[model samples]
Target: MVLPRSSSLKAFLVGAGLCGALLAQSAAQAAESSVWQDVQKAGVLRCGAAVAAPYVMRDAKTGDYSGYFVDLCRDFGEKVLKVKVSFVDTNWDNLVAGLQSNKWDLAMALNQTPERALAVAFTVPATDYQVSLLVNKDNPKLAEVKDDISALDKPDLTFAVMSGTAQDKAISSVIHSGKIMRLPGMDEARLAVMSKRADVLVDASDTNHLFALANPGWTREILPKPALAKQGVSFGVRRDISPADLEVLNIYLRQKRDTGDIQQLVDKASIEANAAK
Candidate 1:
């Protein structure tokens, strides 16, 4: 009922060869899991961007992207990864989605929050910022809200916030008495308060300062207390990225922080803001 010994030997060799092939395929698949390696192989780093001044910006004349965060990404490409850089523009609400969808390799200037951490991984903090408020200068009611940020939380008061942003969540947490106007962009949120369409804009302290510098007629207030949170800003990568890749980003940030590279940027932003004043 059995084949000859030679035929049996041939069958055994075939099964061993099949096992080796399967093992090789499994190893190859494992190697592909390291996203950093893939980036290296591609020789390009795609950065996801949602413009916010001092972080990301474009020159009107030259039409080039130049900001602290943009420059930092370029440094990472040249010094850390040895890759070329390209940018993909997105809105504040969709930056994370772009990274998760593989449209880009890194998400720039993301504020690390628990809700966001659930969807993406963050590098070590690049900077710290406070959640604050900006109110119309012409409003006679400003004095009442001056002593207490939460005083603006009244039925008649309205808050403007960029939709789907952390600031929106922050405002809703504490200002339950006021109505919120969700806007599509940061500029719109600031304008809502500036034009008196809304009473105040819940935003970052630095952002409000920049707005005040640009429009001397407008006034801004730093929230004596944050509604829900303050944010530590960082670059984001997909949750599935390799630990090695994360380490590379962290190391670069640490170097910048230790050398006062970040402080220099803060100083420059301050100078520019003051000049606008």
Candidate 2:
């Protein structure tokens, strides 16, 4: 019952062709499902947002989100990706870790700092801002040193910083003698100071402004402008993001910057921030 030589050869050729076809199909699918492709298939982008003042805020009662970064994220999703937007609540302390863990696709309101760059990739900066100090009005220790920014770096003073932020790094670098109370978010940092648990809280300009607005006469600005302390605020993504996707986001931010749309958004957020207080 042995097959003839020519028939055996013909069957072998058919099997080889089928195998080749299957391999080709698999390769095509793999190409189609690149990370960006998966994003497309999902039809939604997951953006990470933290309650950093004027940038992002959630209404406790209504569960509605507002602020500059929220609007930016929604605009990016709808205008660029043509996808539905979903926001995940995250805090600065865990923001980059969440991105690396695939919890979210983008981290909004991230400031580009040398330390953060080691862990995550940043998009084009949406804006430039400066950091300032927010201190409780009743703190007597700050009264004498209020005139000088560096004078507050005393061993007795305690600074409340949101964990894993540039503010934390700044205090750690400049004020080795002081104690730092690492909090979860800006609100906690402000509360720590107001309650006399900490001497001061360092935050970005608008955020400090928000604290002032919320707690009238309770807090005041000290060292309102730190020398050469400007920071670039940008969105962050995983370090291994596809180059094409990063470029797409960079181009979008550039367009927003050039057209003054981002500034307009900031202006609107400022107004809204004041009203919220």
Candidate 3:
């Protein structure tokens, strides 16, 4: 029905006010949403994770992202959260910086440590791994790893480590060895050792396990003692974010774990051993 000009003016003004208020609320929500929420809304979760074996990797045939950690991020962010997963090829050196600058909202996979806590808060340690020892398949002498990884420091023992990785941090404490080579990521570390350029490559236990399964021809041996270090996996979030924001994300993570969606992904990615079990 037609209204008086004065009434129409009032109605238009009221509608405009409501719209303004709604827009403001939306803006506030966008600001508050953890990277995960932003990902959900964007219809894609931009994740930063090492593009190496059994964590987050590209399939040689299909060129799709696939791995234990990769599957977790994709399934949760894509299937459960209903957001497509887009991964940023990353290594240890720049992943933290990427997050700080808002390059991506989260890391699909990472280990939690006290020092790292200063930069990012994890989502309650979803998985576990050991600092393992890898050696040449043909040579059996390097199979045994002593306690505390002391052998890594021997001048004759060439060891390769993923650059800027937690392994490098741990190794830094005692790397007086021949040549401590730095690789782009764990994958290259394995390659270095495989080609015999380096005597050893220390990576996560589960990562090693998965790597062996994926590449059946490569024979490897675990330290038999794991050498002792506490490393667990969790999702990464910005450090400066609100505690309330973290708690909210924790809620989603807990829900995902309880439903066994997490485990299912682990199995699918062929890294069930990496899961908490």
Candidate 4:
């Protein structure tokens, strides 16, 4: 039997609403996957960058940016995406937030941490990261410490670390007795050690290695036996990025890694950073 006129009209309206909602959801998904299309349309891929020496660096006078991650960003944008690459300066604390707010398309040189994984997506890592300590060559207090970082956990020794960095978190969790001098950037943290305001400078192993190379007689680096916060350093993108878009980045990284181009970039950046010191 056919339904009454009133019932048929109500059913039609409900079905129409459901269909409209489904269409809207599909459109949203399409828009999310269209990030590549959007970049192509704009003709530029903006990368959010924070200076971290070999990973990311900025020129003092010219404000030009360079580093392994910077090179990767340029290569991906220009070679793979066929777009111009632009760097948007940011700091460690804002890298995730900038990506969330659409301030940049990619956040460069971010360590893939579980805390950050909650808010963003990461592409394949360009490099691995581990923490190390930089200390004065004549610091007798650390003479017996050897490879154990825990020996530096003393009230008299102050550790300088870049605020909101992975190194800061790693050291803070274990060194309760030592005073922590949290500074805003790498330069400030290095200065704290140089001026004797802090006894140890905690930073990336690669960075500390370069620093020791630059200041041969003054500083040295200690790589702990049990590495601290060892993780992959990757590019951060919006969590909603489509698998297709994400794959494009992963493929590019794999190609560079297989071709040994990533290592070359690392060496070049390390030399530049050491010479600039």
Candidate 5:
């Protein structure tokens, strides 16, 4: 027993509408894939980052940039994407600004939280680290690891951090001592501890460890109290970037993580630098 002509017509219309919707979705995806192609045509992949030692720091004498962030991104460019990456030597305050203006194609070091996700799209988690406490070696006052950044609340304590960053915000609101000392950049923040200009520095755990090795007389501690927060490290791309390219990069990043290649790079870097003295 078959349906009447009117009923059959309605069913055909419904099936046709579903096919149209599927076709439209496929076309949209095709358009989105154009992003990576555009980058390839441009010839240079501009990456922006600050001079945060062990992250993306510069050499003092040669004025050349170096650090884990630099190493990681450069390899991602040459090895993964097979592109030529050029550095823009950006600052934290200007990272979002630069990306918005299209001055740079990507933000090299980014913390991918929901707030940041709104501003720009992020790649898969390249790494993760926690906020840690750094102090002079002789400063027994800070021996205990602080789970909360608020430990800086003691009127006698002060924090040194980059001039423009989330650390400054954390120090003002949570630490709340009104004693947050400002350094020009990450390099200076590391020095603030050694020169006795600042009591402590709060930054990413791995970076702080790099500083501890370099300074020798300084101690790096991830507070025992509680993680004030853990941030997923990732690369940032502007909202205007093509979704297709971003998807490809995302897949590329995930593959890199799954292969244990990421850890292998870290392990090799650790051995080569031997900075954790």
Candidate 6:
């Protein structure tokens, strides 16, 4: 009660600082809670889509989007969040960066990895993923290898992989001797193998399976005996997203997985992708 003027002034300043800090914390909380609400207000949920077969595919002539993840994005936007859905064309390398820059609300078909987790949040997996090799059936180099991918790790062999993808990293790590031709997209990598520019096309197992099915006579899928980069493929969101906002996505994914809708979408997309081929 008898404190000096300086003491009182110091106390007042301390109180003001605490109040300011509290106010800033409240504002951050409000911003986090409004994440989904912001999308609803915008009236459109923009999904960052990159073409990867059986997961995401874009039609060339019509410019239409398909695949299970695309369906999931549409379902979440229109049915769950009550907003229109739009696809923002991106490639694997840009998926995380686009999410970080707010270029899109979600990045489709992103494999959950420790490196990626540091930059973004992820919902429950929509499906599993593993890397595989798709080689021309007649490639004499692979004839003696069977499932041993290491056998193909020779300087004479060329491996084609989409740059910045999990498969690219996986193959690059193991195939020191082989030439890795990093392409811009899955289609380009596939083209490299089909056109004989590369001896092996490295991609997701599901994608390679579909590709081999579509070209049974020309392509053969090899699931490396030890596997490569096996992980859950999930939708990538901003790291700042609130737990509640992320739970909404997890609930939707759980429902889809339980009802077997996810598998159905996968089958449908595979059929369509093959038909187009």
Clashing pairs in model 4? none
Model 2: per-residue Cα lDDT over 121-217, one tens digit each: 9998998877788887777887776546678878899989888777777667777778889987777887788789899888887778766877787
* Clashes found in each candidate (C-alpha, N, C closer than 3 A): 0, 0, 0, 0, 7, 0
- Reference-based TM-score of each model: 0.83, 0.81, 0.73, 0.90, 0.80, 0.90
lDDT, residue 206, model 6: 88
Scored by CA lDDT, what does every candidate get?
Answer: 0.80, 0.82, 0.70, 0.91, 0.71, 0.91
Model 1 misses residue 210 by how many Å?
1.5
Off by over 4 Å in 2: 1-35, 214-218, 224-229
**Span of 10 residues, lowest total lDDT, candidate 2:** 221-230
**Candidate 5 Cα deviation (angstroms), residue 57:** 2.8
The residue pairs that clash in candidate 5, if any, are 32-244, 33-244, 145-223, 145-224, 146-223, 147-225, 147-226
Q: Write the per-residue lDDT of candidate 1 for residues 146-227, one digit (tens) a residue.
A: 6465677788888899887777777788778889999997778878886788888777777777777777766856565544
Candidate 6: clashing pairs of residues:
none
Q: For this target, which candidate reaches the highest lDDT against the unseen true structure?
A: 4
Better of 3 and 6 by TM-score: 6
**Could you tell me which 10 consecutive residues in candidate 5 have the lowest summed lDDT?**
268-277
Deviation in angstroms for 216 in model 4? Answer: 1.2
Better of 3 and 5 by TM-score: 5
Candidate 3, clashing residue pairs?
none
Model 6 lDDT per residue over 1-277, tens place? 7765998989999999999999999998766655789899999999999898889999999999999999999999999889999999998888899999999999999999998999999999999999998888788877787788778899999999999998888888888988999999888888899899999999999889988888889888788878788899999999998888899899999999999999999999999989988
The TM-score obtained by model 1 is 0.83
lDDT of 4 by residue, 1-277 (tens): 9766998989999999999999999988766656788899999999999999999999989999999999999999998889999999889989889999999999999898998999999998889999999899798887777778777889989999999998988999889998999999999999999999898999999999998888889887898868889999999999988898999899999899899999999999998998798
User: Which sequence of candidate numbers ranks them by lDDT, best first?
Assistant: 4, 6, 2, 1, 5, 3
Residue 266 displacement in candidate 1 (angstroms): 3.0
Off by over 4 Å in 3: 1-43, 60-62, 79-82, 137-148, 213-218, 224-228, 258-260, 271-277
Regions of model 5 farther than 4 Å from truth: 1-33, 140-150, 218-224, 268-277
